[model samples]
Each structure stands twice: as structure tokens, then as C-alpha cells.
Target chain A: MTAWDVIGFLLVLATAAGIIIFSSKQVRGKYPALFRKIPAITRLKRAVGLSVEDGSRVHVTLGKADLTEAANTSTLVGLSALHSIGQLSANSDQPPICTSGDGGFALLSKDVLRAVAMETNTREYYDPDLGYLSGATPFSYALGALDALEESGAKTNVLIGNFGVEAGWLTGNAEKHAQFTLAASDSLVAQAVFMATSQDFVIGEELYAVPAYLAYRPAHIASLRVQDILRFLVGGALLIGALLKSLGLL
Target chain B: MKILNIIIAVAAGLIVLLGYFFRIPAIDDLRGQLLNWAVTLSGVAGLIAILNLIFGVHWKRVKEKHERRGASLVIIISFAVTLVAGIFLGPSSPGFQKLVTHVQVPIESSLMALLAISLVVASLKILQRHRSWMGFVFFLCVVLFLILNSGVLAFTSEIPVLRDFLSAFHHAPVAGARGILLGIALGSLAAGIRVMIGSDRPYNG
Candidate 1:
């Protein structure tokens, strides 16, 4: 590795480790809001509560992100959100159904649901059927999810992950059925689809932030905090790079 | 056990990640081997899931006189036939390719067609509801993109100023898209670091 690569990697590692450690040690104060206001999250909370009261299932679909490097992070973020949904649906008559296009993602979803069930002391309600491999590709997965949504009569549909243009199909289906739909994606096309279809859609890093809001675990909060800091650092770097280029100093 | 697994995960993850950046031969070999194992395991898992879906879910549903028994039967037969054809004739064989080309391609094309309609409906909905400048801008861009591609305004390309304006307008959204993509990349990198460090353990369960 080059010196710059090694230095950059170590810098990030150290900074993240320090932040995580410090954040973990902090306790709640009188005014202890760790993150900024996300209106979509507030709406999500209300939607989940309403869905529970109305005896309708919340459908959570992690779109067609497989175990490849290009999509692995999106899958992980989806799983994190699924973790929150699992907890949210714990007391409800209808627990959230987690579906994925990839088998590996589906298997991981099952594990997350199982963990949630265990945490909620609802192990008996834990069903592997709840986390399913819907289809192998994006379109097939969307169609499969649409079928499930129709059959289950789910009131709330939360879609997150690496959906493509096919996300429009699922989100449109939800809207047509008058389901309360919220969506987030790493894909720009899918994000556009979500913005068009979902009334309250999480944008960009907001998908990762939802889990922190739902669970408020120190680690999740710390990770979000670090992400924000890193984002700012990137923004600063971009500005500086632009300035240097304009000045012909590079 | 959990601690051990976490350590293993971190170590293996670090090895694979660094192997990409660093040109260490040993780490590269290790990365390749681990990736192969992952792919192989994933393939096996997929096969098992397919079999379970066909037999454990679809077959059981058919046997139990479910409402969608016909659908279940169709799924099972199609899956079985595809699997057998794929195995016996080989995945590259004409039958398997034809099955994919005829069935999968058409389904994908249908979804794409649906996406076009949905996009129009969605854009219209946005205009009707939001009626904001940004929404109007989006709608205008969509229209312009469609018109440009439709070849109805192909003669506009002959006009230098009009062509420049159209070209710049077409690429404007792409710039915004690139910014969003950069943000996603940075966010993903940060999140991946969290996972690697075991702070945000989606794999824990």
C-alpha cells in the first residue's frame, strides 16, 4: 500500500474508534438529544403505532442487494433498519414481514428477526417464514413483494436497501392499495421513486439514522455521529480541492 | 463464542478490505480464498432455499388446499423443470437460455414498462400535490428528457444554442446524481467501518 492509503485508513480507524469509545461512555443529560430531527422518523413511529393498533402487519422489504461489495453496505443498513422494525412490531398482532431478493440477505433477515423476537420475549412468534427470499432479481422481487402485500393486507410498507427502478413498482403498488408507505435506498433512481411514491421517505444517510432513532443504542448513535463528522470532513475536502484547483495550486 | 466470532469477523473483514488496497500476495490469496468460500456458501444456500420454497412451502400449500394451490403447483413445476433442465442440459444449454430469455426477459421488460407509467403517474402526483418549484423543475426535466429521446425535437440539435442548452439541461440532473452518489459512497464507507469494528453489528443476530 502507498503511504497515503495507509495513513488515511489508520486516520479513519483511530477517529472512529475514539468517537465510538467516547460516545459509549456518555450518559443521558437533561437535554440529551444525540441526533438532529428527522420528520420521517417521527412519522414512521406514528405509522408503526397505528398499524399495531389497527391489527395490520408492517411489511419491511430489503430490496435486491446481494453479498457483493457494491451492495453489501446497503444490505447491512437494511438489516439495521429491520432490527428497528422488529422491535417496533414486537407487541403487535402482526409482526413485520422482512423480504429480500437475495438468499443471503433473507437468511440474515431471519437472524435479525429471531434476535428481535428473543429480545421481546416473543420467541414462540418467531417464524423463519417471516423472512423470505422473495425472488432472485429486482423486478421479480418487487412483483413478489407486491403479491405478498396484497395477500397480507399490510397497512404499513417500509422498503429500504438497494432497489433499482423496479422500486417504483412496489412503491406504486403500495400507494395504489392505500398503504402507508415509507422508503429509503442507496440507489439514486430508487430514491427518486421513493420521493415520488412515499409520503415520508428517508433520504441518503437517513436510512442508517432510523435504527439509531428506534433503538438508541450507544453504538448505533455513535456510528451515526461518526458518519456525520466524516461527511463534513468530506465536504470540507471537496471545497478545499475546488479552491486549490481554481487557484491553480494543485 | 460471540466475542470469538466478532474477532474472527473483524480480522477476516480487515484482511479482505486491506487485500484490495495493499498488494500483499499473502493477503490477496487469503482474500480470494475467503471470497470463493463466501460465493460457494451463498450458492449452496440459494439452492437449499429454492428447494425449500418448492417443497416445504409450495408443495405443502398445494397439499393443504390453500387458496393459491394452482399458483403453488405452477411454481413448483416450473422450478422443478427449470432446475432439472439446468442440471441435465447445463446452464449454458439452449433450453435453459431459452427459458430465461423467454420468461425472465419478458417479465423484466413488463416491469420496465410499468416503471415508465408509474414514473409519469408519480411525477403528475407530485405536481398536483406539491406544486413546488423543485417539483416543477423535475417535471420539466422529465419532459425535456422524454422529448429529446423521442426524436420529435431531433431537429433542435441543428440549432447550436438550442443543442447546447438541451445538452447542458440533460447533464444538469447527472451532476446532482453524482453528488448524491458521492454522499452514498461516503455514508457507506462510514457504515462499513462501523460494521467492521463491531459497533453496528447487523451480523450479530
Candidate 2:
């Protein structure tokens, strides 16, 4: 809202645009993996593949990410991962199930599923019921997901989005019922719970690294490149700010 | 059709973005209108989703003769009764408020109590499941913070070096958390810019 805030936003926007344009080209012809190995993503991908072979569904629960909040970023990350997984598991007997706590996000998730289904020529196997809003509130969402997870009988559970302390129930339930489970969230509180309960807890921004790891597609790779560049820029900014403040110049 | 969807979405997003940067009266009005429409649509979608979730879950159970059929019926009844009561008596009504205060709060509190127990069991299981150095370090850090910050050792604060060390330890998580938050912010910006450039479109699948 202030001048400095606007300047900062525009600075980031310009940098992102530059990197995105550059990386879009570089991602062509099998770019080398630029990211570290994430064990959680490895397990998540394997769980999806194993679900395909075993003919069980992979349950993807995206907790409430209201459009008006910053947590919607995590929802975008979730949607991308879902799309990648949808394409990867398109030929399976049962398509992955997507659940959300918000209706708008549920709609977006359903669209991603439908689009993936269409592109893969698996329209016949796709069901509209595959995507749904689970519950309205935090605890209700978790309790609702518990019932849904039980009913679906999915072997693999992947929970990614904006979760709160209420995620304890869903992760606890998944731990008990599912064969493979990995949970991630943008909320620090939820992340704490996940570290303790979930089979694989994706820490920090590794949640954002999911699509690049899962799909290995060009666009996601480009996004990842932009992210890395921005991280360096941010780290440099932090160091500069610290030095300036220490010298009484900031 | 896909191109049109992308264009429409991008255009609307641009307008919204512009509204944030500029405080012009006309742009502000337009932004308000657009946001109002979005809120209305979101509310309608929520209503539809709730109804679908309630009826669909219970209906499928009943039709399929699932073991939870009886429980499903009870849920359906509870949802309908609650909906009817909420609509007729209004959300601000004392009885409706009691439904939240008396029933919902107790249930949520019990679950929170369960979460505390779960946290303890999960920490123990962390050792059993993940015996790596990272796991050990994580467990050590958490336990160290827990014990140190709990005022269990007041004598340590009397020593200047120990007090300084403990103070720094208390602030360590904040620094780490701030670093993580910065990473997330950068990632969000990248993701949002991708949408703007049409490199990613989760809206139309």
C-alpha cells in the first residue's frame, strides 16, 4: 500500500517475468535437474504409480484455500501437482480423487482433473464426483475427509494445501488407513503436525517443488527456475538490509 | 474456447492487479464490483457444495447398502434439521448460537485434546520410523526448545553466557521460520506470474 511496497512488488514482478522468459527456452531438450532430491516427492510419486498398478485410487485432499488469502498460493501448487498426477495416472482403472474444503478451489481442482482426463482420452473413466468440497470449517474438513477416505478405500493419501492444527485428524486417519501418505501445508502450525504424524512430511517450500519433481515438464521447470533466482535475490536483499541497519544507514 | 478462457481470466486478473497499484476512483469501483460478484458466486458455490456433500455421501451409502448407512441417515437428518433451523431462526438466534457453542466447540475441543496425545505418539514414532541424522537433529532441536523455554531451569538464566545462549536459542526458530516464509513468498510470486503469462492455467484444468 505504500510507495516502497509498490516498488518492491514491481521489482519482483519484473524479475520473475525476465527469468520466466529465459527459463522457458532453457527448459527445452532435457534440462539437467537443478533441484535437490526431496524424499517426500519420491514417495509421493511412487505412491501414485503403485496406486495405478494396484487399481486403487490416490486420494488428494486440498484443505481450504480461500481465494482471498495468501494460502491460495499453496492451493495453486496443489492444483499443479494434481494435474501432473492426473496425467500420470490417467490410464489407471480408478482416477485419483480430489477433495477441497472450499467450493471455488474444489471447482478449480475438478477442472484440472477434467482437463487432464480429456487430454489423456480418459474421459470415459472420469467421474465428476471425483472432485468435491469436503467440509466448510477446519475441523469439519478433517472429520469429513476421514469419512471420505474410509469410503473411497484409497491406498495412497496425498494432502497438500493450506491446513491448520485441524489437520491432525486427517493425517492421523490417513496414517491408520492408507498404505502410503505424505502431507504438506503452507501453514506453519499444520507443518508441525505433519512432521509428527504423516508418513512423509514435506517441509517448507518443498511443497512448491512438487510439480517440478512430479511432472518434469517444461513450464513447471521454468517456474522452478524463477523461484530459485528470486530466492537468491531475496537472500541478498536480507543481507544488504541487515548490513545497512547495522551501520545506521537503512 | 481455451484461449478465450485464458484471455478473460488474464484480463480480469490484470484489472485486479492494477487496482492494487492504483487508487483511482473508477478502477476502485470496478474492482469492488468484481469482488462483490466473486463473493456472491463463491457463496452460491459453497451452498451447492455443502448440499452435494451431504446428500451425495448419505445417498450413495444408502443406495450401496454400506455399513455406515444408518450413520449416514443420522447425518442427513442432522444436516437438514440444522439447515432448517438456521434459515428459519436466523444465524444470530440464541438457539442457533448454542448449536455452535454447545455442540461444535465441545467436539472440536475433544479433538484438540486428541491431537496433543497424537503429537506425543507421533514424536516417539518419528524415532522409530526415521532414524536418520536429520530426524535426530529435528527431535533434538524440538526437545531442546521445549525444555529450555518451559522455565524448568531458572538457574541457567542467572549466568550471563547461558542466558544469552538461551535467548538466541529462543529466537532461532523465528529466524528459520522467517527464512521459510521468504522462500514461500518467492515461490508464490513465481507461481502467480506463471498464471499471468498463460504458462499455467489451473482454472480451466
- DockQ for the candidates, in order: 0.55, 0.62
Candidate 2 structure quality by residue, lDDT tens digits, B1-205: 8889989877777677777778878888888887788889888888878777776666778788989899878778878888988999899999999986897899889988988898788887877766788778878988898898788977987899988988888899999899878877777877777776677788882
- Model 1 interface CAPRI class: medium
In model 2, the clashing pairs are none
TM-score of every model? 0.91, 0.95
Instruction: Judge the docking of candidate 2 as incorrect, acceptable, medium or high.
Output: medium
Can you write out model 2's per-residue Cα lDDT over A1-250, one digit (the tens) per residue?
Answer: 7897698668657855665665655545456646788888888888889889989988888988886666688888889989988988987979888889998887787788899888899989888778888888888788878777877888988898999888888887787778998898888888888877776888887888888898866667777776777778778988999999999998
- lDDT at B154 for candidate 1? 81
Per-residue lDDT of A114-203 in model 1, one digit per residue for the tens? 888888998887777777777777787888788777767888888888898888888877876635787888888888887776676877
Give the alpha-carbon lDDT of every model.
0.78, 0.82
The alpha-carbon lDDT assigned to residue B174 of candidate 2 equals 96
